[model samples]
Target: MSSQPPEPPPPNPTTAHGSDRKLRADARRNRERVLRTAQQLFATEGLGVSLDEIARRAGVGPGTVHRHFPAKEALYLAVATDQIRQLVAEAEALAASSDPAALFTLLSAMMASGAENVAVKSALVAAEFDLRTAAPDVAADLTRHVADLLDRAHAAGTVRSDLTVEEVMALVAGAFAAIRHIGAETSRDRSAHIAQLILDGLRPHPR
Candidate 1:
Protein backbone atom coordinates (compact mmCIF):
# COMPACT_ATOMS: atom_id res chain seq x y z
CA MET A 1 0.00 0.00 0.00
CA SER A 2 1.20 3.50 -0.75
CA SER A 3 2.41 5.33 2.40
CA GLN A 4 -0.07 7.94 3.58
CA PRO A 5 1.15 11.55 3.59
CA PRO A 6 1.94 12.84 7.08
CA GLU A 7 -1.04 14.73 8.42
CA PRO A 8 -0.51 18.44 8.91
CA PRO A 9 -0.07 19.54 12.54
CA PRO A 10 -3.18 20.83 14.24
CA PRO A 11 -3.57 24.62 14.49
CA ASN A 12 -2.53 26.10 17.82
CA PRO A 13 -4.67 28.78 19.46
CA THR A 14 -1.87 29.66 21.91
CA THR A 15 0.45 30.37 19.01
CA ALA A 16 -1.88 33.00 17.56
CA HIS A 17 0.04 36.09 18.71
CA GLY A 18 -1.61 38.19 16.02
CA SER A 19 -5.03 37.33 17.37
CA ASP A 20 -3.93 38.33 20.86
CA ARG A 21 -2.62 41.64 19.54
CA LYS A 22 -5.94 42.33 17.82
CA LEU A 23 -7.80 41.66 21.05
CA ARG A 24 -5.58 44.10 22.93
CA ALA A 25 -6.12 46.76 20.24
CA ASP A 26 -9.86 46.33 20.49
CA ALA A 27 -9.76 46.67 24.28
CA ARG A 28 -7.71 49.88 24.01
CA ARG A 29 -10.18 51.34 21.53
CA ASN A 30 -13.09 50.58 23.84
CA ARG A 31 -11.31 52.12 26.81
CA GLU A 32 -10.54 55.28 24.87
CA ARG A 33 -14.15 55.60 23.75
CA VAL A 34 -15.34 55.22 27.31
CA LEU A 35 -13.00 57.91 28.59
CA ARG A 36 -13.96 60.35 25.83
CA THR A 37 -17.68 59.85 26.37
CA ALA A 38 -17.32 60.11 30.11
CA GLN A 39 -15.37 63.35 29.81
CA GLN A 40 -17.96 64.95 27.55
CA LEU A 41 -20.85 63.86 29.73
CA PHE A 42 -19.15 64.98 32.89
CA ALA A 43 -18.44 68.40 31.44
CA THR A 44 -22.06 68.87 30.38
CA GLU A 45 -23.86 67.14 33.21
CA GLY A 46 -21.37 67.01 36.01
CA LEU A 47 -19.90 63.87 37.66
CA GLY A 48 -23.28 62.65 38.84
CA VAL A 49 -24.11 61.12 35.45
CA SER A 50 -24.61 57.34 35.57
CA LEU A 51 -22.03 54.87 34.36
CA ASP A 52 -24.71 53.17 32.28
CA GLU A 53 -25.30 56.40 30.41
CA ILE A 54 -21.61 56.82 29.85
CA ALA A 55 -21.34 53.27 28.55
CA ARG A 56 -24.29 53.75 26.22
CA ARG A 57 -22.82 56.94 24.85
CA ALA A 58 -19.45 55.27 24.41
CA GLY A 59 -21.04 52.28 22.67
CA VAL A 60 -19.53 50.01 25.28
CA GLY A 61 -21.06 47.81 27.96
CA PRO A 62 -21.12 48.55 31.68
CA GLY A 63 -18.67 45.67 32.04
CA THR A 64 -16.25 47.41 29.72
CA VAL A 65 -16.48 50.65 31.64
CA HIS A 66 -15.84 48.94 34.93
CA ARG A 67 -12.98 46.99 33.46
CA HIS A 68 -11.31 50.16 32.29
CA PHE A 69 -12.00 52.50 35.20
CA PRO A 70 -13.01 50.34 38.17
CA ALA A 71 -14.54 53.43 39.81
CA LYS A 72 -15.60 56.99 39.12
CA GLU A 73 -12.71 58.36 41.12
CA ALA A 74 -10.22 56.48 38.97
CA LEU A 75 -11.79 57.88 35.83
CA TYR A 76 -11.70 61.36 37.31
CA LEU A 77 -8.03 60.94 38.05
CA ALA A 78 -7.39 59.91 34.46
CA VAL A 79 -9.15 63.03 33.18
CA ALA A 80 -7.18 65.23 35.55
CA THR A 81 -3.94 63.58 34.44
CA ASP A 82 -4.83 64.34 30.82
CA GLN A 83 -5.49 68.01 31.64
CA ILE A 84 -2.20 68.26 33.50
CA ARG A 85 -0.40 66.84 30.47
CA GLN A 86 -1.94 69.47 28.21
CA LEU A 87 -1.00 72.22 30.66
CA VAL A 88 2.56 70.96 30.78
CA ALA A 89 2.76 70.94 26.99
CA GLU A 90 1.49 74.53 26.81
CA ALA A 91 4.01 75.61 29.41
CA GLU A 92 6.86 73.96 27.52
CA ALA A 93 5.87 75.64 24.27
CA LEU A 94 5.68 79.05 25.94
CA ALA A 95 9.04 78.62 27.67
CA ALA A 96 10.97 79.78 24.64
CA SER A 97 9.01 82.97 24.04
CA SER A 98 10.87 86.20 24.83
CA ASP A 99 7.91 88.50 25.42
CA PRO A 100 6.61 88.58 29.00
CA ALA A 101 3.24 89.91 27.90
CA ALA A 102 2.87 87.13 25.37
CA LEU A 103 3.89 84.52 27.92
CA PHE A 104 1.34 85.83 30.41
CA THR A 105 -1.31 85.81 27.70
CA LEU A 106 -0.56 82.21 26.87
CA LEU A 107 -0.64 81.20 30.54
CA SER A 108 -3.99 82.91 30.98
CA ALA A 109 -5.38 81.03 28.00
CA MET A 110 -4.24 77.72 29.39
CA MET A 111 -5.88 78.44 32.71
CA ALA A 112 -9.09 79.36 30.92
CA SER A 113 -9.11 76.01 29.16
CA GLY A 114 -8.72 74.27 32.49
CA ALA A 115 -11.58 76.25 33.96
CA GLU A 116 -13.83 75.18 31.07
CA ASN A 117 -13.38 71.48 31.74
CA VAL A 118 -15.53 70.55 34.71
CA ALA A 119 -14.25 67.00 34.84
CA VAL A 120 -10.68 68.28 35.04
CA LYS A 121 -11.47 70.59 37.95
CA SER A 122 -13.36 67.91 39.82
CA ALA A 123 -10.53 65.53 39.27
CA LEU A 124 -8.06 68.11 40.49
CA VAL A 125 -9.96 68.47 43.76
CA ALA A 126 -10.48 64.73 44.10
CA ALA A 127 -6.80 64.08 43.59
CA GLU A 128 -5.76 66.80 46.05
CA PHE A 129 -4.09 68.31 43.08
CA ASP A 130 -1.39 70.85 43.70
CA LEU A 131 0.97 72.01 41.00
CA ARG A 132 3.86 70.76 43.06
CA THR A 133 2.15 67.49 44.04
CA ALA A 134 0.91 66.63 40.57
CA ALA A 135 4.24 67.44 38.95
CA PRO A 136 7.11 67.81 41.39
CA ASP A 137 9.92 69.25 39.32
CA VAL A 138 7.49 71.10 37.09
CA ALA A 139 6.51 73.54 39.86
CA ALA A 140 10.04 74.75 40.44
CA ASP A 141 10.81 74.88 36.75
CA LEU A 142 7.73 76.93 35.98
CA THR A 143 8.34 79.28 38.90
CA ARG A 144 11.92 79.88 37.75
CA HIS A 145 10.81 80.46 34.19
CA VAL A 146 8.13 82.90 35.23
CA ALA A 147 10.53 84.63 37.58
CA ASP A 148 13.03 85.02 34.77
CA LEU A 149 10.38 86.52 32.50
CA LEU A 150 9.22 88.88 35.23
CA ASP A 151 12.80 89.87 35.94
CA ARG A 152 13.36 90.72 32.31
CA ALA A 153 10.21 92.83 32.27
CA HIS A 154 11.26 94.49 35.48
CA ALA A 155 14.73 95.31 34.19
CA ALA A 156 13.19 96.78 31.07
CA GLY A 157 10.99 98.95 33.30
CA THR A 158 7.86 97.12 32.16
CA VAL A 159 7.04 95.12 35.31
CA ARG A 160 7.54 95.55 39.05
CA SER A 161 10.53 93.90 40.72
CA ASP A 162 8.93 93.97 44.16
CA LEU A 163 6.36 91.28 43.46
CA THR A 164 7.51 87.81 44.49
CA VAL A 165 6.85 84.66 42.47
CA GLU A 166 4.69 83.45 45.35
CA GLU A 167 2.61 86.56 44.94
CA VAL A 168 2.19 85.89 41.25
CA MET A 169 1.07 82.34 41.99
CA ALA A 170 -1.45 83.70 44.48
CA LEU A 171 -2.86 85.97 41.82
CA VAL A 172 -3.17 83.07 39.40
CA ALA A 173 -4.89 80.98 42.05
CA GLY A 174 -7.37 83.75 42.74
CA ALA A 175 -8.14 83.99 39.06
CA PHE A 176 -8.76 80.26 38.90
CA ALA A 177 -11.05 80.41 41.93
CA ALA A 178 -13.00 83.26 40.39
CA ILE A 179 -13.35 81.34 37.17
CA ARG A 180 -14.63 78.38 39.13
CA HIS A 181 -17.39 80.46 40.69
CA ILE A 182 -18.58 81.89 37.39
CA GLY A 183 -19.35 79.84 34.29
CA ALA A 184 -16.30 78.98 32.16
CA GLU A 185 -17.05 81.25 29.19
CA THR A 186 -17.88 84.13 31.46
CA SER A 187 -14.98 83.27 33.71
CA ARG A 188 -12.51 83.13 30.85
CA ASP A 189 -13.49 86.53 29.50
CA ARG A 190 -13.53 88.07 32.93
CA SER A 191 -10.28 86.43 33.96
CA ALA A 192 -8.47 87.63 30.85
CA HIS A 193 -9.67 91.15 31.50
CA ILE A 194 -8.74 90.94 35.16
CA ALA A 195 -5.33 89.48 34.33
CA GLN A 196 -4.60 92.34 31.99
CA LEU A 197 -5.61 94.77 34.68
CA ILE A 198 -3.35 93.04 37.19
CA LEU A 199 -0.48 93.11 34.73
CA ASP A 200 -1.00 96.80 34.20
CA GLY A 201 -0.81 97.47 37.91
CA LEU A 202 2.29 95.33 38.16
CA ARG A 203 4.05 97.15 35.33
CA PRO A 204 6.59 99.77 36.38
CA HIS A 205 5.89 103.39 35.69
CA PRO A 206 8.41 105.13 33.46
CA ARG A 207 10.61 107.66 35.32
Candidate 2:
Protein backbone atom coordinates (compact mmCIF):
# COMPACT_ATOMS: atom_id res chain seq x y z
CA MET A 1 0.00 0.00 0.00
CA SER A 2 1.04 3.59 -0.56
CA SER A 3 2.18 5.80 2.33
CA GLN A 4 -0.95 7.94 2.01
CA PRO A 5 -3.70 7.60 4.65
CA PRO A 6 -6.69 5.31 3.97
CA GLU A 7 -9.54 6.81 1.96
CA PRO A 8 -12.56 8.11 3.85
CA PRO A 9 -15.73 6.00 3.93
CA PRO A 10 -18.47 6.50 1.40
CA PRO A 11 -21.36 8.88 2.13
CA ASN A 12 -24.54 7.72 3.82
CA PRO A 13 -27.25 6.29 1.54
CA THR A 14 -30.13 7.78 3.53
CA THR A 15 -33.05 9.48 1.85
CA ALA A 16 -32.58 13.10 0.77
CA HIS A 17 -35.43 14.55 2.77
CA GLY A 18 -34.31 13.03 6.05
CA SER A 19 -30.80 14.34 5.70
CA ASP A 20 -32.09 17.66 4.52
CA ARG A 21 -34.42 17.99 7.50
CA LYS A 22 -31.77 17.14 10.07
CA LEU A 23 -29.35 19.41 8.35
CA ARG A 24 -31.93 22.18 8.36
CA ALA A 25 -32.63 21.70 12.06
CA ASP A 26 -28.95 21.75 12.93
CA ALA A 27 -28.56 24.82 10.75
CA ARG A 28 -31.39 26.56 12.51
CA ARG A 29 -29.88 25.87 15.92
CA ASN A 30 -26.49 27.03 14.78
CA ARG A 31 -27.95 30.19 13.33
CA GLU A 32 -29.86 30.98 16.49
CA ARG A 33 -26.79 30.38 18.63
CA VAL A 34 -24.68 32.58 16.42
CA LEU A 35 -27.19 35.38 16.49
CA ARG A 36 -27.57 35.16 20.27
CA THR A 37 -23.81 35.17 20.75
CA ALA A 38 -23.45 38.05 18.33
CA GLN A 39 -26.10 40.06 20.15
CA GLN A 40 -24.36 39.49 23.48
CA LEU A 41 -20.97 40.40 22.10
CA PHE A 42 -22.29 43.46 20.30
CA ALA A 43 -23.75 44.65 23.57
CA THR A 44 -20.78 43.98 25.86
CA GLU A 45 -17.86 44.29 23.48
CA GLY A 46 -19.40 46.47 20.77
CA LEU A 47 -19.91 45.47 17.11
CA GLY A 48 -16.21 45.18 16.39
CA VAL A 49 -16.03 41.69 17.85
CA SER A 50 -14.92 38.93 15.50
CA LEU A 51 -16.93 36.14 13.88
CA ASP A 52 -14.52 33.47 15.05
CA GLU A 53 -15.05 34.68 18.60
CA ILE A 54 -18.79 34.64 18.17
CA ALA A 55 -18.71 31.10 16.80
CA ARG A 56 -16.51 30.01 19.66
CA ARG A 57 -18.82 31.58 22.23
CA ALA A 58 -21.79 30.01 20.49
CA GLY A 59 -20.16 26.58 20.71
CA VAL A 60 -20.08 26.22 16.93
CA GLY A 61 -17.30 26.15 14.40
CA PRO A 62 -16.27 29.22 12.40
CA GLY A 63 -17.63 27.47 9.35
CA THR A 64 -21.06 27.50 10.90
CA VAL A 65 -20.98 31.26 11.25
CA HIS A 66 -19.82 31.64 7.69
CA ARG A 67 -22.42 29.24 6.43
CA HIS A 68 -25.16 31.25 8.08
CA PHE A 69 -23.59 34.67 7.51
CA PRO A 70 -21.05 34.84 4.73
CA ALA A 71 -19.71 38.21 5.90
CA LYS A 72 -19.51 40.20 9.10
CA GLU A 73 -21.92 42.64 7.54
CA ALA A 74 -24.31 39.77 6.86
CA LEU A 75 -24.18 38.72 10.49
CA TYR A 76 -24.73 42.29 11.58
CA LEU A 77 -27.68 42.61 9.26
CA ALA A 78 -29.28 39.40 10.52
CA VAL A 79 -28.97 40.46 14.15
CA ALA A 80 -30.27 43.91 13.36
CA THR A 81 -33.13 42.61 11.24
CA ASP A 82 -34.33 40.32 14.01
CA GLN A 83 -34.33 43.24 16.42
CA ILE A 84 -36.34 45.43 14.08
CA ARG A 85 -38.96 42.73 13.54
CA GLN A 86 -39.44 42.47 17.29
CA LEU A 87 -39.73 46.21 17.95
CA VAL A 88 -42.11 46.67 15.07
CA ALA A 89 -44.31 43.84 16.28
CA GLU A 90 -44.40 45.27 19.78
CA ALA A 91 -45.23 48.71 18.47
CA GLU A 92 -47.98 47.31 16.29
CA ALA A 93 -49.54 45.42 19.20
CA LEU A 94 -50.17 48.73 20.92
CA ALA A 95 -51.83 50.17 17.85
CA ALA A 96 -55.39 49.79 19.13
CA SER A 97 -54.78 50.85 22.70
CA SER A 98 -57.21 53.40 24.08
CA ASP A 99 -54.47 55.38 25.74
CA PRO A 100 -52.48 57.31 23.16
CA ALA A 101 -49.80 57.75 25.83
CA ALA A 102 -49.14 54.07 25.35
CA LEU A 103 -47.46 54.93 22.06
CA PHE A 104 -44.76 56.90 23.86
CA THR A 105 -44.58 54.11 26.39
CA LEU A 106 -43.84 51.73 23.55
CA LEU A 107 -41.17 54.08 22.30
CA SER A 108 -39.62 54.35 25.75
CA ALA A 109 -39.63 50.62 26.23
CA MET A 110 -37.98 50.02 22.85
CA MET A 111 -35.45 52.84 23.25
CA ALA A 112 -34.43 51.59 26.69
CA SER A 113 -33.63 48.17 25.25
CA GLY A 114 -30.19 49.52 24.26
CA ALA A 115 -28.14 47.51 21.77
CA GLU A 116 -31.13 45.46 20.70
CA ASN A 117 -33.08 48.58 19.83
CA VAL A 118 -30.26 49.90 17.67
CA ALA A 119 -31.61 48.01 14.65
CA VAL A 120 -33.13 51.11 13.10
CA LYS A 121 -29.69 52.69 13.04
CA SER A 122 -28.17 49.48 11.84
CA ALA A 123 -30.71 49.35 9.03
CA LEU A 124 -29.52 52.78 7.95
CA VAL A 125 -25.87 51.76 7.92
CA ALA A 126 -24.06 53.14 4.87
CA ALA A 127 -24.56 51.63 1.40
CA GLU A 128 -21.04 50.30 1.70
CA PHE A 129 -21.82 48.47 4.93
CA ASP A 130 -24.11 45.75 3.45
CA LEU A 131 -27.15 47.11 5.24
CA ARG A 132 -29.30 48.81 2.63
CA THR A 133 -27.57 47.84 -0.59
CA ALA A 134 -27.08 44.13 -0.05
CA ALA A 135 -30.62 43.68 1.20
CA PRO A 136 -32.95 46.19 -0.34
CA ASP A 137 -35.93 43.98 0.45
CA VAL A 138 -35.14 44.03 4.14
CA ALA A 139 -34.56 47.74 3.99
CA ALA A 140 -37.98 48.26 2.47
CA ASP A 141 -39.69 46.05 5.05
CA LEU A 142 -38.06 47.99 7.88
CA THR A 143 -39.14 51.30 6.41
CA ARG A 144 -42.69 50.05 6.02
CA HIS A 145 -42.83 48.85 9.62
CA VAL A 146 -41.60 52.17 10.93
CA ALA A 147 -44.13 53.98 8.80
CA ASP A 148 -46.91 51.78 10.16
CA LEU A 149 -46.00 52.62 13.73
CA LEU A 150 -45.85 56.32 12.99
CA ASP A 151 -49.12 56.22 11.10
CA ARG A 152 -50.87 54.47 13.96
CA ALA A 153 -49.59 57.01 16.46
CA HIS A 154 -50.49 59.90 14.22
CA ALA A 155 -53.98 58.53 13.68
CA ALA A 156 -54.33 58.20 17.43
CA GLY A 157 -53.26 61.83 17.75
CA THR A 158 -50.45 60.70 20.04
CA VAL A 159 -47.23 61.69 18.31
CA ARG A 160 -46.52 64.78 16.23
CA SER A 161 -48.14 64.66 12.80
CA ASP A 162 -45.38 66.59 11.12
CA LEU A 163 -42.67 64.11 12.13
CA THR A 164 -41.70 61.52 9.55
CA VAL A 165 -40.95 57.88 10.27
CA GLU A 166 -37.31 58.47 9.48
CA GLU A 167 -37.18 61.22 12.08
CA VAL A 168 -38.75 59.00 14.75
CA MET A 169 -36.41 56.14 13.91
CA ALA A 170 -33.45 58.49 14.17
CA LEU A 171 -34.64 59.71 17.54
CA VAL A 172 -34.88 56.19 18.89
CA ALA A 173 -31.57 55.21 17.34
CA GLY A 174 -30.02 58.32 18.86
CA ALA A 175 -31.23 57.15 22.26
CA PHE A 176 -29.60 53.75 21.71
CA ALA A 177 -26.36 55.38 20.60
CA ALA A 178 -26.34 57.82 23.49
CA ILE A 179 -26.85 55.09 26.07
CA ARG A 180 -24.27 52.85 24.45
CA HIS A 181 -21.77 55.68 24.39
CA ILE A 182 -22.50 56.81 27.93
CA GLY A 183 -22.70 53.36 29.46
CA ALA A 184 -19.38 52.50 27.88
CA GLU A 185 -17.64 54.90 30.25
CA THR A 186 -19.83 54.56 33.33
CA SER A 187 -21.63 51.85 35.31
CA ARG A 188 -24.98 53.56 35.12
CA ASP A 189 -28.00 52.34 33.13
CA ARG A 190 -27.89 55.44 30.98
CA SER A 191 -30.55 54.25 28.56
CA ALA A 192 -33.43 54.20 31.03
CA HIS A 193 -32.92 57.79 32.14
CA ILE A 194 -32.22 59.11 28.68
CA ALA A 195 -35.16 57.27 27.18
CA GLN A 196 -37.48 58.95 29.65
CA LEU A 197 -36.24 62.35 28.61
CA ILE A 198 -36.72 61.47 24.95
CA LEU A 199 -40.19 60.21 25.70
CA ASP A 200 -41.04 63.60 27.17
CA GLY A 201 -40.75 65.11 23.73
CA LEU A 202 -42.41 62.24 21.85
CA ARG A 203 -45.54 62.40 23.97
CA PRO A 204 -48.70 64.01 22.64
CA HIS A 205 -49.50 67.68 23.23
CA PRO A 206 -52.99 68.77 24.21
CA ARG A 207 -52.68 71.94 22.12
Reference-based lDDT, each prediction = 0.68, 0.69
How many pairs of residues collide in model 2? 0
Q: Which parts of model 2 are misplaced by more than 4 Å?
A: 1-15, 95-102, 113-127, 180-188
Candidate 2 lDDT trough over 10 residues, lowest sum: 115-124
Question: Each model's number of backbone clashes?
Answer: 0, 0
Question: Per-residue lDDT for 1-207 in model 2, tens only?
Answer: 659889998777677678999999999888988887887777667667888999999999999898888877777777876665665666567655656565576676666554443542443465346445655666566567567667777887877778887787788768777775765313335557787778777766676
Model 1, 79-160: lDDT tens digits are: 6556555565666666666665644654565556555564456566766765466656656666666676666666666657
- Location of the lowest summed lDDT over 10 successive residues in candidate 1: 179-188
Q: In candidate 2, which residue pairs clash? A: none
**Candidate 1 Cα outliers beyond 4 Å, as residue runs:** 1-36, 97-100, 118-158, 182-188, 191-202, 205-207
Taking all chains together, each candidate's TM-score versus the true structure is: 0.64, 0.70
What residue pairs clash in candidate 1, if any at all? none
